[model samples]
Target chain A: MTTLSVRNLRTHFFTKEGVAKAVDGVDFDVAPGEILGLVGESGSGKTVTGFSILGLIDPPGRIVEGSSIRFNGEELTAARPERLRAIRGSEIAMIFQDPMMTLNPVLRVDTQMIETVQAHLKVSEADARDRARKALVQVGIPSPDERLRAYPHQFSGGMRQRVAIAIALLHKPKLIVADEPTTALDVTIQGQILFEVQRLCRESGTAMIWVTHDLAVVAGLADRIAVMYAGRIVETGRTADVIERPMHPYTKGLIGSVPSQNTRGHKLAQIPGMTPSLLRLPRGCAFKARCPIAIDQCNEMPALEEHRPGHWARCWRATG
Target chain B: MIVYIIRRLMQAALVMVVMSVLVFAGIYLIGDPVLMMISPDASELEREAVRKALHLDLPMWQQYLLFVNDALHGNFGKSFLAGQPAMGLIFERFPATLELAFASLVLSLAIGLPLGVYAGLRPHTAGSKTIMTGSILGFSLPNFWVGLMLIMVFAVLLPDLVPGWPRLPASGRGATVDVLGVKLSFLTGDGLLHLLLPAVTLSLYKGALIVRLARATAREVLPMDYVKFARAKGLSERRIVGVHVLKNIMIPIATVSGLEFGQTVAFAVVTETIFSWPGVGKLLIDSILLLDRPVVVAYLVIIVFFFVALNLVVDLLYSVLDPRVRLESRAT
Candidate 1:
């Protein structure tokens, strides 16, 4: 069974100026034990998609009508708040970008973890602590016993992220929406965390949506990749196909701009334009102004089409 | 911690010495107590005798030296008018003022914290708007005017309007029960009733201060990533607000509350006078009018002591609320 299936999801922010469609008609799915990398630049709504899955959108922003988010065949967009909260951190979990910001500074690690356990399960304090200790060990944290008594600030940057990962893995959730969990970390630490996360997901058979802007990061870790632009997924396919045989012009430009893709001592390829503001999008294709292969016919909005097996692109020229 | 406290105590001793010097020199400039004490019909010889007896004839430096020596020996001289030891007089009234200050502090925390949290959490709600507006009124109104208005409403007007309402006495501690050799008015029902009006009047401004502080801090902390993380952990709304939001906001609240408590204790003068409460603040004002040097000096010195002690308590509380502070201090 699919761990998550999102179809026609439109999350909009109703500001005084205009309705900003942050996530516009997005569709994707993750099978059990699969890793889907939701790759996008800033303002592309990758994080918003993650938050919507958890029903964490606050006032002035909402998952509009006609959107569907099904986790294990259960519709989440229409679920009650209590039901959504129950599913969160137990059936589904989330990990944020900044580890330093995620854990409560005033609370000790054990206090935070124990309460997290008690929030869903009716377990004794000692039992909860025992589980927390085990979770910490599973994430490869040294001195798990003493570390539980320390505050968030006491740990180094890498260690803090390990704690956050441990907390997310405590409930053995079936799905995790990690939003750039290692972006703020150093390169070595990022690799270590990626390795740990991949190992844990494989061991637990947990499906995960890894949201990031780094193509290089997902190239190695993600089984499939979904490249997003202007709040919509422009192209998606298996990681090897998306990287080596990119169909959409936007995805080609993204893969070309990576520093490792070009010959040594050569000027790196660059995408020409900034992301369009979501409040007032252009009339037809959002990437028309920036697309190098634009023609007179590019004025019309293109629909996502499968040009190859299990590979989709949102461009008219993909078939040609 | 012990070293820190010992250092703080040494600094406190220095501050008290400097404060005593300033108070001594300042009081000397205000006019001779001998001039204000004796009758107008008294002869020059009587004035000279009074000056010598009170040591007013000595140089200011010499007088201060004598005062310091007596203070070192736990004798802060005697009140010129009352002919009683100044420390004894102040100590007798200290409990009443402290009780009033503490009562108002408790009242403020009990009322202000919840309202502030509510206002911060749902800042756009109508009830929060009303609470914020009331806090603004609490801040802007003068203490004496608020005290008078409260007296007029609860003590004077309400009793006249409602036949069954008891006529609240406008002044004095009604009756006191001695607990551990300190007279407390809150023990008996009538005494508590007598305390109610003055306590409310005293608490309003401080309560408003705490509300603004707590609201601002809570608003700042509510948007922190830790708070959102708490929600993502499947925590109930109440647990998120109570544990995460409250704990983070308490740092600033504790600091402001401690300083404000010290201020109320030192300067509840207008409230004490309006209600005719025989507390240290009233005694201070009376001593100033009578130019009772020893009593005024003793009062100010004690206030300084309270401030230093309260600051220490606040720092200690900071360690408890924030572990970073605790660990760093331990490291040092």
Candidate 2:
């Protein structure tokens, strides 16, 4: 059973120049107590997909009709705005990159946390403060009382991100869409946050979608990995299987580009060519030009097919 | 807080000392007030007596010394024309200007803030475009011309168009009531009617200024990650705007509004002239033309003090709105 099931989801931006399809016909299911790493290059649709699940897309960008997002068996796209709002902070939560920018600089930590609690729950101010203090403790923040009274600017970068995570955990949400929440942090802090988040998800049975461009992060953190390109997922599988035996050439290229001890003192291999502009994507497999083994069969876009159990890739020619 | 206030007062005193010297020197260069006060046909002996009586015959430095001595003793001499204490004269006209400035400030904020926030929130809408265009007119039009047009429209044209419509009085403080020994026109119906025109005329420019400032600042602050985070938390749109957006934008708005209030009080000469409102601005203009040294110096010194106090208030207001500023000040 899944906490969230997205099917044929298409989020497009209608600008004056053209309709840029940011997320095109994507499908994924996140089970309770699972972490799904949505991996991509900078221009890929991972962040947009995250936003789509939250129903947080703003104007000029919209989730096209017929796209279905079901959370806990309820259709999210068809829900009223108030209903969607009701599900946002309590049932589902989001953590953004740059925690320094995410917290209001003018407000105290307690005020921000208390307001978040009050936004969904009808608790008294004292109860909300207690919840805030508890959430801070859950995130391993020391001296929660004093920290709650301090403004966001008073905290260091890592501390601020911990506070943001605390805010997300305040209601023990069932799902969290973290858009590179630790990407701006130091490597050590990143490891600490990943551990805390992994433990929190397992303990609380909450599903998470961690959107980032870093493959190494997802390799260690996510149960499954989905690699995207040009608004489509090119490959998704169990993290070990995908990392060891990537079916899609694009995923293989992505894994090759990461520097490891084996590739020490050697120039790292990279996918040749820039990420294709979504406004003017090539009319076939978006990765055809950059694919090392692209063939005539790649002239037409390939549908995702399971080449092995629980491992899927979008490519015409794939053999184990 | 006590230390802050004490420091600010000390700075104000230094500024006042410098201002007094400049004003004293500046008035000396504006020609003698005795000439303006005395009859043109007066004999030479009579002119000498008048100049000595008003201290116009003394050397500029000696005259300034006497003025400072009396000023330290809570005296600024008397107006050459009215023969009343110059400070007393200014104080009498002070209420009218204070009330007018306050009314204008209230009107501008009431009208400007919402329209500006709407424009900022939806910059592409037709309504926002229209407001932006109207603000341009408010900014570009000369104050006197706008004041005259207001008179032509509301005072002159509206009454003619609709019979039995109460025509707003064109000039003077109308039908004042005594409040705590102060004559206040706004307390009475006729006085409020008379106040409407000048107040609106003065508010238009400030209102437009506020609109542009609010719109720009709001647009800048609206997209901040905190604002988006606020939305993500499921807080209602009203709370986001009220607490997050409004509180942040209020820093710049408070500063501009405070300085604007001081400016209106001191320099609303054109509006006062068009509406013939008996305010300090009108009195200052009349005093300048008559070259009444004591009144001119007294009015300017009071304005300087007013500005100093306003700046202090704005700084305090900034601390209230933003905790970062409060924390920094406390640390110091």
- Lowest summed lDDT across 10 adjacent residues in model 1 chain A is found at A260-269
Candidate 1's residue-wise lDDT over B131-248, tens digit each? 9999999889998998898889888999999999988877988899999989999999988888888888878988898888888988898888888888888889999999999999
- lDDT per residue for candidate 2 within A110-218, as digits (tens), equals 9999999999999999999999999999999999999999999999999999999999999899999999999999999999999999999999999999999999999
lDDT of 2 by residue, B80-191 (tens): 8999999999999899999999999999999999999999999999999999999999878998998898899888998999998778888998999988878899999999
Best candidate, TM-score-wise? Answer: 1
User: What DockQ results for candidate 1?
Assistant: 0.82
Worst 10 residues of 2 chain B by lDDT: B323-332
* Local distance difference test, candidate 2: 0.91
